[model samples]
Every structure is written in C-alpha cells, then in structure tokens.
Target: MDSLLSVCDIKEDVSYIIDLAIKIKAGEIEDMPLEGKTLAMIFQKSSTRTRVSFDVGMYQLGGRAIFLSSNDLQMGRGEPISDTAKVLSRFVDGIMIRAIEHEDVVELAKYSNVPVISGLTNLEHPCQALADMLTIKEHFGSFKGKKICFVGDGNNVCNSLLLIAPLLGMDMSVACPEGYEPDENILKISKNFAKDNNTEITISSDINIALDNVDIVYTDVWVSMGDEAEKAKRLKDLKPYQVNKELMDIANDDAIFMHCLPAVRGQEVSADVIDGPQSVIYDEAENRLHAQKAILYHYLK
Candidate 1:
C-alpha cells in the first residue's frame, strides 16, 4: 500500500494531482471512483481544517470518513501504533493520522495493510502544503521562478514548503529566528532538489532580506499547537519577524499574504494583513478540501 507521509512522497506528481483538484473544485466531475471505500481518520491533534476537509473530501468522493478521536481509540490508552494500524487496516481502505511525533505515522505505515496518510506531524504537513501550492497556482497561473518568502517560525509548514517548492520550480526563502531554523537534514535534501530543479532555496535570520521582491509572503503562529508553554518566549523572540504592513512593503506590489490558520492576529501576522484584501488564508483553507480530494483519488485508485 502507498502512503503520503511527506511532500517528498508526492514529489513531481503534485502538479498533476493539484490539477485534478482544480477540476473537482470547478464542478467538472460528479462521481469519484472510491464510492464504497472507507477512510479512517485518527487525529491526536485537535484541528478545524484538517479534520473537516478530509471528512468532507471523502464524502464528496462518495466515500465514508470515520472520525476516530485519540480519546475514543485504544491507541490513545497505551496501545502500540503498529497494533492499531494492523487493526484499522482490516476495516478501512485508508488511514489518515494527525499526530505529534512523525515516527508514529511511520510506525502505522509499517504494520498497516492499507494506505496510511499523514494528516499532520511535528516535522511536516504535506497535505496543507499541497493546498497552498494549489492556491498559488490558481492566483499566479504558474509556479516557475516565482519567489515565495516564508517568515516566522520554521516549523512543519515551513519545512514542507522548503521541500516541495523546489519540485515545482519555485524559489523559496525562509526567514526565522537564529535557533529556530528548519531541520538541517531536510534543508539539505531540499537544497539538493532545488539545485537539480534550478530553483533557489535560501534560509536567513534577516526577514527583510528574504522578503525582498518575493511574490508570496507566508507565515505561521509564533507558537504552534501543543507548544503553549513556549508561547510567551516565542512571542518575545519572534515579534521582530512579524508580517505586518511594514514587512509587506518590502515585497513586490503584487505579493499575496498567506497563513495556515489559527493565526494569532497580532503575533505572526497583523489583523489588517490577514483580514485584508491581499490575504489568501481563507482561500488556502478552502483548497484543503479540493487538494485532499485529489490526494485521495491518486492513492485510492
């Protein structure tokens, strides 16, 4: 069985998959082939977008999405992830997991007979990145040579962007605090992919330098979910990197603002910017449905 654990897992085929999603969004298709299939969704992390989109996407495709909360499952009460995977594989056509550790997803895939998808992990958010890419394509028409700048915490979202952007020929710049830089191994791997694809990927501590002439300005919260204890400290250190009007001015006139929500209004992005005309946060959020439909179609078939 195949799985979508990272952006790298989809690789160069993302554009094709996203095109299918666009077709779905435009109402060009009626019956999706996975009519009788079942998607078992296991989410350890509480979410709005990921949970809703996958459940809705499966419904749209004529499939059933069974929501399995962490507390509702034996896996939450000390059962091994592999054992859970093995059991779920017997009942579901596919499994989607949103968890804290990336390894848990890997372990599930190891023992499962059915396909396993990574809904969200601490290390990468491949599905969200796919949606973001679809939105970018919708607005810009093409990703080739477009500079996308991401400012703030170099977390999972940033990590996926760094890895996936190169595959589509998009130049990417990430600006973050000194010690909060993206995973070095992931960075190195993406850089190598960038080199081969003729796309430049740069990471810097200087926010202004990264935003210069960038076509897209992306950001996430100073503190992600489950990082509540670090919130105060992160807000202090990351305030300088916030994407407000001042930071947006450094980018090109057409640069669009993007955030993977639940955005902290005054923290990672200003309210005026996120709620303003240029913001594509809602559009990004909506595309989650479309993009996952594409992913489900690809893997299920």
Candidate 2:
C-alpha cells in the first residue's frame, strides 16, 4: 500500500496487517525491521494515544519518531501541504499527520514521496480502527460471527469503524441521533464493502434496536476536538445514546465495551460501564502501539 489515509486504502491487506500486529504484540517479530527508518509525526490536533503510541512503537522497532506540532511546522504559517509533504518526505522514511481536515491528510499523501499515515482526521481515524480491530481479535480470538454497534455521534472514530469492521468479516451498526449520522459517501462505500465481504451494515436512531445483542458496544465522546463551540448542543442531542449500564445490558452477555479515549465519563459513556469488567478500552489503547508498528513495517520497511 502507498499510504493509509483511510481504512479503505488498505482494504485487501486489512487481515494481513492485523495478523502482523498480533504477532508483533506477542513478541513474535524478533528482528527490528525498521532499524534505519524515521517517522515524522505532524500534529495539528493534540492527542494522547496517537502521539505516544507511534513515538514508542517506532523506538521498539529500532527506528525513531519526530514530533511536530502545528507551531513547529511551516504549514502552520500558511505553507501548503504539498510543500510540507515534499520536504518532509526527503527527511523521513514516513509521515503521520493528525489534522483538522481530512482533505489535508489526503493532500499530504498525494504529494509525499514516502507513505503518509492518517493519525487522525475529522473524517476518519484509520490507525485507531486498526487498534480496535486488533483488540476485538484478541478478546474473541476471531472475527467470525461477530457484530459491533457504535453508540453515539458518528464522528471520525465511528466512521473508521464503519469502513473497517465489515471488511474484516464483522457486521457493524451505528446508533446516532438525527442530523448526526456518518458521512453519506463513506456509509455508501462501507455498505458496498459489506456486500462483497458477506457482512452487514445498519444505522438507527433507536438505541435499543441498534445495540441489541451485539458482540461489541462502542462509544466515543459527544464533543470532539475543535467542537467546543457546539458542546452544549451535542451533549443534549447525544445524551440519550450514552452507553450506560442499562445500555450495556442490551448487548450480548460477553460483549466488550470500547471507547477511543479522551472520553468524558458521564457524556458518551457512563463511569460504571467504562470502568466495568467488560471494558477493553485500555487494551484497545495499548494495541495502537502494535498496530502502528505493523503499519510502519508495511510502509517503511
């Protein structure tokens, strides 16, 4: 694959990458395949998992990571993404960008000579999707006959899950309020991908119908970065969709709970459920390191 700007970009190799991540996490990857590589991390958005995981993962793979915030890069000073992509490609083996605009991530990958990974974007979180898949595989030992329900705002993390889940042989459902559904084009593409992969996709406003008996019941914060302005409205709209104990009870008995972190306890998910025994948020977060290591190996090594 040239780059991973979206999960769909690496659809055919999704299973391979997940397998590599599993092996890497289990200490099965003996040799450091990325001994001489360097990854430049450009962050227009602040993060905890994306930043630390990529940084540490590179080190463990015998490579290194460079952190570049918006202030550190010329792009913050109005330099075009094309110029930044071209220049950074000459200095680093790969680029990982967490940006406000999905278009910017696409533009960077288009211009860069090296592979560009979408660390996170307003439209999709491809790396996070990889980690989530890795976590699910670890919990259940396989993807067969599994269903995942994304409960809340259909934002970046949910969008990535929509695209990747069905591709990996898992059915996906999203329960969101009206005017808060996933992107139309992405939903269409994911549905098409589902058909070919023999899985299913569904969306609903009724949380009960959507969450019913799913293997994974996942949620993300109602308000996201750059969304502080609409926080009150978002909280009001998504309050009913929160993954509380009652909501969790609607899922399968063995269902695991997940959140792409920086989660608000009483907003998208309750403290009880997120801190409960079934929650795998920490394991999911940890898998970010292994998954991105596999991504690094695939593109840079």
Candidate 3:
C-alpha cells in the first residue's frame, strides 16, 4: 500500500501486521526492519500515544523519527500541503500525519513519493484500530465470530472499528445518542462488508442492548480534540453511555473493557471501571507502539 489513510488500505495485511506486532511485543523478532531509514511525523493535533509510540517505534526499529508539530513546519502557516509533501518525501522514508482534516492526509499521500500513514484524522484512525484488533486478538485467540460493542459518540475511532470488525469476521455494535451517530457513509460501507462476511453490524441508542453478550466493550471520549466547544452538550448527551461498573456488568463476564485513552475518568468512563481489573487500557496503549512498528515496517521495508 502506498498509504494507510484508512483500514481499507490495509485490509489484506491486517492479520499479518497484527501477528507481527504480537511477535515484536514478545521480543521474538529483533531485526531492525526500518534500519537506516527516517520517518517524518507531522502532527497537526497534539497527541500522547501517537507521538510517543511512533517516535519510540522508529528507534526500536533502528531508525530515526523527527517530530514536526504544526508550529515546526511551514505548513503551520499557509504553505500548500502538496509542496510540503513533496519536500518531505525527498528527505524521509515515510511520513505519518496526525491531523484534524482527513483530506490533509489524503493530499499528502497523493503528492508524496514515500508512503504516508494516517496517525489520526477526523474521519478515521486506522493505526489505533490496528492496535485494537491486536489487543482483542491477544485477549480472545481469534477474530472469527467475536463481538465488539462501542458506546459513545460514533467518531473517528468508531468509524475505524466499523470498517475493520466486519472485514475480520467480527460483529460490532455502535451505540450513541440519536444525533451523534457515526458517518452515514461509513455505516453503509460497514453494512455491506458485514453482509458479505456474514457478520452483523448494529447501531442503536440503547447502550444495554449493545453491550449484551459482546466479547469487547469499547468507548472513547464524548468530546474529541476539535469538539471542545461542544463539551457541555456532549457531556449531557453522552452521560447515559458512560462505561461504568453497572454497564460493565451488563456485558459478558469475561468481556474486556477498552478505550483509546486520555480518557476522562468521570466522563467517558468511571475512575473505578477504568482502573478496574477488567480494563485493558494500558495494554491497549502499549500495543500502539508494536502495531505502529509493524505498520512502519510494512511501508518502509
């Protein structure tokens, strides 16, 4: 793949990368696949996991990563994305962008000679979904017939999961407030994929129904980075969907709780539940390193 702007770009390679991440995490593979290469990490949005994971991942692969925040690049001002992409392609083996606009990543990929990875965007977060799949596979043994339920605003992370779960023969349910549902285009695409894979995709406002009998209970913050102004409204709308102990009780006894973190303990999830035994948030966070390493290896190698 020339770029990983969406899960669709890595569909055939997902399992391979997830398996590779497992091996990397276990230290079974030590060769530096990206040795002597350099990765340009452009961040239009601030990050904790995405920043640390890719930087450290490149180091572990015996390469270098340059951290370029919005303020660090000419693109921060008014430089055209195409010009920046072309310039960076000459210097770096690969480029990874965490930006607010999905189109920015698309434009970078379109213009760059090197492979481009979408670290995150408003529409989808492919890398996070890859790590999530790895974490789920680690917990469950396989993806076939597994069930995952997402509770909260159906945002970028939700969109990525909707694309991936059906492709891997796993069923997924998304529960959100009426007006806060996932992108309609993504839902339609996921539905088609589910039909072909013989998996189910359901969207509902009833959180209880979504959690019932699922193997994984997942959630994300109600207000994402660009949605800070809507915080109060989102908090009010999403309060009922919080992944507290009572909600967790509704899921299967062995169901794992997951969040793409920087979680608001009292908002998206309760402090007790996030810190609880069933929560795999930390492991999930760490897998970001391994999963991204695998992705970089795929593009850079």
Each model's lDDT? 0.91, 0.93, 0.93
Each prediction's RMSD to truth: 0.9, 0.9, 1.0
Q: What would the per-residue lDDT of candidate 2 be over residues 1-301, giving only the tens digit for each residue?
A: 2999999999999999999998998899977788989999999988889999999999999999999999999999999989999999889999999999999999999899999999999999999999999999999999999999998899998999999998988999999999999999899999999999999999999988898769999999888888899988998999899899999999999999999898889888899999999999999989999999999988888
TM-score of each: 0.98, 0.98, 0.98
RMSD of 1: 0.9
How would you encode candidate 3's per-residue C-alpha lDDT over 1-301 as one tens digit per residue?
A: 2899999898788789899899888888867877899999999999999999999999999999999999999999999999999999999999999999998999999999999999999999999999999999988899987899999999999999999999899999998999999999989999998999999999999987887689899999988888989989999999999999999999899989999988889998999999999999998999999999999888888
Please give the ranking of all candidate structures by TM-score, highest first, separated by commas. 2, 1, 3
- Candidate 1 C-alpha lDDT tens digits along 116-235: 999999999999999999999999999976999989889999999999899999999999889889989889999999999998999999987888779999999888888899888898
Model 1 worst lDDT run, 10 consecutive residues: 25-34
Report the number of clashing residue pairs per model. Answer: 0, 0, 0
The alpha-carbon lDDT assigned to residue 181 of candidate 2 equals 99
